[model samples]
Target: MMCLKTMMVCSLRQQILPILGLLLIIECIISLKLLELRVPSHVPLGTRAELSCSWQLGEHDVLYSVKWYKDGREFFRHVPRDLEPRRKFPLPGVDVETFDTSGGNVTLSPAVLETGGRYRCEVSGERPLFPTVSDHADMLVVVLPDHGPMISGFRSRYRTGDRVQVNCTSGRSRPATQLAWYINGEPAPASAVQSAIDKKTEDLETTSMALDFVVQETDFKKNGLKIKCLATLAPVYWRSNEESALKEKAISNQLLRSSLEDVKVTRADRVLANSAEFTNSWRHVVLLLCSMPNLFLRGLVWFPFFLQEI
Candidate 1:
């Protein structure tokens, strides 16, 4: 009886070990996982954009379907078992060009401004296991400006105590560009910055800002006074325009006149000193000539010419 019991125990142990090994293998081989979800954070409007979703399936698992959703609404579907593996549903602002099954990549031609939103990619395994994995990311469709900010209402020059008022305008965009003012590389004072104005044209927007301040003597630097307008669209576009201003001509002319007066005064003083010296030398010569009688008469011939010159 003891020998029979030992054989039965060995048989049970052999069966249990094989069952446990098979379970471990099944667990290891059956899995559906999301590897990567590629969505652009910013896409330029009216341009093509490609989004990719990659996944991994274990040896025993089979890919059932891959679905893409925009703002929680299904837009694209791919099922390997179907006669047509790829299908696209109509969704506003989502223009599906092609869906590549080999790598599960989706392409959108001429993405519009309304295409900006949260996107999700979901992957599922074939029946029996039915494992699912998903991931999501946000995308923005941006309308970039064709050019930098433009400055207007600028004067040829500004002087101390003069009021300066100017406007900065940005190119048309989907979302209006934000504008800021800088004076001499520093942020303009809040008191000097006016409110931003927005203009809309057929779904595109343009923004402008005004800057007003009184010119001060301290505003001028070695490079002259600089006024800059900065335009930005968050996380994507940044541009600026700058203008330089000099002191008014009146002030410059006054300084130039003062310099000229100083030069004139110096020249007059030098001339007077030279004339006094020449007169004294001539008087000494006249006295010496008077001492010599014969030379005195000859000196008189040149005296009239010399007096005329004097």
Candidate 2:
């Protein structure tokens, strides 16, 4: 009975060791396998985006499949030995053609605003006695604005004391646009700003703002006052443009001349009254001189007559 038990223990040990050795070898092979995924941290809207998948495995191991998922939904699949070597599944709001995906790489043609989300790639390898060795990588896809905002709606010239209105519009962009204003490189007054959504298309929106204020004399002090509009589509993407409004000194001067004309008229009226009074006094003096000459000649003639009478 002791010898039978020893034989049974030896058989069990022999079987278990081989199985353990195979498992260890499989683990070692899997340790050699490497799966790499590459993609940009952020993709700009209306641009092509690429998601790359590459791998390295043991010499005898075969690449079973490569799959791509977005937000946990499969969008691309590849298999070496299959009726269809590559297959593309439908993903809403993504425009991908067969030509866009090739050799474990998926390309998005004109990546859209809503296409941004979580992306994952799975790679699988087949090795003898190993239940499909697989690895996956997760990445976050953020969509950024393709371009900066566009500014418009302010005239080239402004007069002092004139009311001016300016509007700045940002180009269509994913995510709401934030707008700000600067005048002569200083923050604009909040009371002068009014913002609204200019347009909307699906998830993309265009935003604009109106800056209305009365042009002060100080605004015309500079040769050209710069009013800049900054439109921020995302924290990473922003655009700014400055519009120059030249000081219309000609207009200001005209207004100043008009104001001075009234003062000039009042001064002219006082000078005219003083001139009339002086003319009357001079006329009286002239009349006295003429009478004195006549009286002196008459007195001389009367004196001769009196002598003759005496």
Candidate 3:
């Protein structure tokens, strides 16, 4: 009886060991995998963006559901058991469309500047056996400017006492560009600048700034004064425009020479007498000669080219 009982116990142990091994094998084989989630390295504002997710599972394993999240908010879902395989939740400022729920792909048409952030994708299988698997990827949306900011209202000519008006205008920008002016390689005073929203289209806006100041004689000398307009969209984009003041010193000198020639000596004998007697006429001539340096005409040269900023 003892021998028979020992043999029965061995048989039961063998059966239990095989069943446990089979269960382990089945558990190893049933797996839901989230292989990868793809997002663009750079996505410009007001342009299209594509996001994809790849998953794998065993032949017998079923894909119960898939989900997409942005910054912790679930915006897309796919359930194979439901009649509608794909569904999208409205996320303000994010224009999202799911192209394929089974394939795990979506598109964002004309992405907004504020829509860039962390993204996550999740895949689920049979709940009690195969659990949910998830993967994450970061998408840093880049907001690119529509075009370079432009500098306008700077003329090619100006008198010394004239008020110089320079305008900086930016193309359609989402956050409304910031503009600043620099004169003679220095930032222009705030009192001399006036900014406004020049134009708008839908959600985008254009920014403009006008700088007004009196032209000074020093602005025309040597290398010619430089005026610059700077536009900023924070860390995303920085653009600028540079202009040079046009100096016509030779023309002014020619005009002075012509004036001197036109002032003919109506009374040669009287001019000689005044010259010999050290009269006020001689002092007037000396004063006129001293004032020649201050008569320079300072103007501006408009550049046709616009530079790119990254």
Query: Which of the numbered candidates is closest to the native, going by highest lDDT?
Result: 1
Model 1 lowest lDDT segment of ten: 24-33
Model 1 Cα displacement at 301 (Å)? Answer: 41
Candidate lDDT values, in order = 0.87, 0.72, 0.75
Tell me the number of clashing residue pairs for each predicted model: 0, 0, 0
Tens-digit per-residue lDDT, 1-310, candidate 2: 9999999999999999999998877665675454677766556656677777666766666677777878788887887788988887888855555433335677776766567777777777654544343344443333444566556668888777777787887777656678898888888888888856568777667787888889877765457777888876443577788888788765467788987997899899999999999999999998887879978788888998999999
Q: By lDDT, highest first, what's the ranking?
A: 1, 3, 2
Which candidate, 1 or 3, would have the higher TM-score against the true structure? 1
Ranking by TM-score: 1, 2, 3
Residue 177 in candidate 3, Cα distance off native in Å:
1.4
Best by TM-score, which number? 1
Runs with alpha carbons beyond 4 Å of true place in candidate 1:
1-31, 56-60, 248-310
Backbone clashes in model 1, listed as residue pairs:
none
- Model 3 TM-score? 0.44
What are the runs in model 2 whose C-alpha is more than 4 Å off? 1-36, 39-47, 58-60, 90-102, 109-117, 129-168, 180-204, 208-225, 234-238, 245-310
lDDT of 1 by residue, 1-310 (tens): 9999999999999999999978865674456678899998888888887889998888778888999999999999988889988888899999788777553798987888778999999988887657788999999898898789999998878878889999999999867889999999999999999999999998888999999999888998873789999999877788999999877734578899999999999999999999999999999998887789977787879889999999
- Candidate 3 lDDT, tens digit per residue, 12-95? 999999999788656644556677889875566777778899988866677888888888898888898889878888776565
